[model samples]
Structures are given as structure tokens and as C-alpha cells.
Target: MSRKATITQKEIVNAAFKITKKEGFEQITSRKLAAAAGCSTQPIFRIYENMDGLKKDVYDKAAAYYEDYYNDFNKTHEVPFVDLGLAYIGFAQKYPHLFRLLFISGQGTGGRSMYDLVNGSTENVVKEINKATASGAGNAQQLFMQMWIFIHGAGCMAVTGDYDLDEASSVAMLESAYKAFCLG
Candidate 1:
């Protein structure tokens, strides 16, 4: 009789996620995943059909992370909107490899644009933007689009290591963009 498999899907994904977090998705070899999971390579294949399957699982986890947890920029800054922008750049600087996977290489999201991810994932902050801009929710969304342009630019530059901006300057630029949108 064949032995029953014991490893779960969550375990496999978690192990892959950890490796991807540190080394980017390319490091997710069968041996590395097995070592991380404390199991043989057989179990990884048993749980996932192939590396691409495992990658898709990890990609979902990463997407959910930015959508839910990594977006908490409010703890550092009084203004949630500012926190949101700072958080993007900080995430890029902190996770340059992962940032490239998410934004630059377009590993996930099925060719959806970054603006879609920004707009879709950022509905939580519309209320804060509304309050800051003293505008209706409709106008606040427009403001978010403008602010996102600045934030996304900095984030792209951050991962490229081309423009190493300090916190003060980033905040000033975001504020300026916000003000520009609010004016008209």
C-alpha cells in the first residue's frame, strides 16, 4: 500500500513564502523548500504539481500581504495618507527583490497595471484622503491617483537604487502632490 501524504498545502506555501521573502522567487528550489519545511522534496511535489503552481500560491500570499498587512502606514505617521505613501517606499527599500517581483517584473496580477493594484488595494484610505483634502469621496479618489503617481515613482526608483530619497523629502513631495490635487 502507498503511504498517505502528511504535508499540507499551507505548510508548502508558507515555506515558499519565507524563501521568496528573503531571496526572491527564483530561490525557491525543491531542495531549499524541502530544507525549509523540514521534509523531503517528494512532499513538495506531492503538494504542488510544479514550481509554477507553488509560485502562484506564494504570489497570492504576497498580494494579500500588501493588500492587508504591509499597508499599515498609519502607525508611523499621523496622516494615514502620508503613511500609505511612505509605506510603499519603505516596502520597496526594505524588500527590493520582492518589490521587483510585484511591481517591476509583473510576476502576479495577470498583467494588471500597477495603478489597478494601487487603486484597488487602497480603497481603505479614501476616507482619510477625503478628510485631508476636505473634498468629496469622488474628488478624493482623484487625489489618490495623483498622490499614487508620486509614491509609485519613488517606489520604482527605490527598488532601482537610483534615487535614494530621505524621509523628509518624500513626505514633502507627497504633500506637495496632495496640495496640487486639492487646488484643482
Candidate 2:
């Protein structure tokens, strides 16, 4: 029998993910993925029916990476909610292409809008905000949504490089806006 193949589907998908991270999802062509994977385009076709299938896998990978990256601060920080907000903005600034793919281009919503996805994921965040605001979690939905809108705006600006935000000022903004939304 012939020797076993050297590369696997996961490796190929990971290479595609790296390319998506650097160049955005739209740039994930067969050639680009092949170049990133350090192999010919044959492996891509051998593993996936087409670029779309590979792209779908890549999207799933990126979503998981995004969630993991954001959730990393869940236990480390004293103020996990504000820390998560800062992490969101930091992710945008650090990975603009991934940010565009995840937030602006809207490639991986699975038929749901990003707004819906974000709102749906805010259950835990609402609980955190409730703890911070001394309000009940059930009552913090609107407050969390408001904070999300602002935090996401800052991330968008970071991705676009239109505004250079400093941490101190962002912290101040987060504090004031959070207080207003949570108490008002």
C-alpha cells in the first residue's frame, strides 16, 4: 500500500483560518489557502468538495476562536464585564481582518443576524452586569444591550482605524455609560 498522506483536513482548515485572520474571509482562495498550508491545491479539493465547504469549516473555526478569545477574561479580571468590553475592542484592533469577517462582513451568522447572535449570547453578560449594577439579571437586558452597542461601536472604530482609543478614556466612557444605562 502507498504511504499515508502527510497532511490532514484539520491542518488545511487551520491554514485557511490563518489566512482568514490576516487577509479577511474573502481572500481565502484555493491558491491562498494552498500557499498558507504549504501544499498544493490538491489537498484542498481532496478534503473539501469546494472552496465553500472549506470556507464553512474555516468560519466555524473562527467563531470558536473568537468565543474562546473573548471568554478568556471570564475569571482573570476583577471586573469581568468591563474587561470583556476591553477585550472586544482589543480583538478588533489586533485582528482587523478577522473583525471584518466576524462583525462587518457577516459571513458566519448561520442565517441569524449578528445583532441577534450578539443579543442571544448576552445572557451571561447580563448576569455579570446585574451583579455590577446591583440590579437583577432579568432587568439588565436593556442595559447590557446598550453597553453592547457602545462597545461594538468602539470595536468598529478600532477595526476601521478611524479613532485611536486610549484605555483610560475608554474605561471612563465604559464606566459613565454603564452607570447611565444601568441606573437610568
Candidate 3:
């Protein structure tokens, strides 16, 4: 009888993500990822056309996790845009390597857009902005793009060891920016 397959594509992708989170995205490889998943490279190749496919899957999973994280916060409490900015910083601080992989640096050969990393999160933030603002003159998408650029810039600076603003200071800065853009 044929031996039962003991590995799965999701397991491989999850292992790859864990590897990336622990040892930076630059160090992740098919062989290392396969080892972490406790499977041979053949199973990885069977599920994914190549490493690029695996990378894309990893990115997708990360994005989903990020979205869920933000959504969970929303469900628990009503946080402002500035609070979301603080959460962004917290995430980066907590997972410096993974944060770099998802935002600061681009990985894989799939030509995936950086915007994909924040797709769902950004959408939810925009919806909150819309609800917070009653005028509704400008489009939420445009406002979200502007706020996202600001947040990403600040977050990247923090992750790259460039900015040293503390949590309170960061929240203040984000609040100021949100007022200027989303509220004003």
C-alpha cells in the first residue's frame, strides 16, 4: 500500500512564515522551509510550482493574519485611526523581521504589490474613517491612501532603527496627522 501523505500546502506555507518571522525573509529557502515543515522538498514542489508560489502563499497568509488582528481589535473596542497607528507600531515592534518582510522589503518573484500587505486592514480603516467623518466630501479610498502612506513611512522609519519615538509620542503624532487629513 502507498504511504499516507503526512504534509500539506498550508503546513508548508505556515512553516515558511514562521521561518521568515524568526530569521528574516532573506534567509528563507525551500530547503529550510521544507525542513521546518518536516517534509521533503517534493511535497513543497507538489503543492507549489516553485518557491515563488510558496512565497506568494506566505504573503497571502500574513496579510490575512494582519487583517484578522486589526478586525479583532475593532470588534473588542472602538479605536480611532490614531489608535490603529499605535497598533501598527506595536506589530512592527513585536515582529520586527516579519514586519520588514511584509512592508519594509519586498520578497518573492511574483511581482506582488506592496499594497496587498495592507489591503484588508486599510479597507477596514477607511470604513472607520468614513463612519467617523460625517461630511463625506472626499473619497475614503483617497484619504486611506494618504493615511496609509503616512503610517507606513512612520512605521518603516521605526523598524529600520531610524525613528525613536516612544508609544505615547507616536500616538500623538498619528493623532495630529489623522486630524489634519481625515478630520480636517
> Model 2, residue 41: what's the lDDT?
87
lDDT digits (tens) for residues 1-184 of candidate 2: 9766777999998998888888887888888888888888887788899777877787777766767776663434444256757878888998888777777875764675555434335455655665665644345667777778888999999998975868777777777777677567
Question: lDDT-based ranking, best first?
Answer: 1, 2, 3
Off by over 4 Å in 3: 74-80, 106-122, 135-143, 181-184
TM-score of each: 0.78, 0.81, 0.76
lDDT tens per residue, model 3, 21-124: 77876688778878899988888888888767777787777766666766665332233456566667767766777777777666623554655455463575
Query: Which candidate number has the best lDDT?
Result: 1
| Each model's lDDT | 0.74, 0.73, 0.70
Candidate 1 residue spans exceeding 4 A from truth: 75-80, 109-122, 132-138
The candidate, 2 or 3, that scores higher on TM-score is 2
Question: By summed lDDT, which 10 consecutive residues of candidate 1 come out lowest?
Answer: 71-80
Off by over 4 Å in 2: 1-3, 74-80, 109-124, 132-138
Residue 38 C-alpha lDDT in model 2: 89
Better of 1 and 3 by lDDT: 1
Per-residue lDDT tens digits of candidate 1, residues 1-184?
A: 9988778889989988888889888878899999998889998888788887887788777777766655555545544367678878888998876777777776665665665454456565554566665544347767777777777888898988876779898787777776667777
- For residue 151, what is the lDDT in candidate 2? 86
Task: Flag clash pairs in model 1.
Answer: none
Q: Residue 165, candidate 3: how far off, in angstroms?
A: 2.5
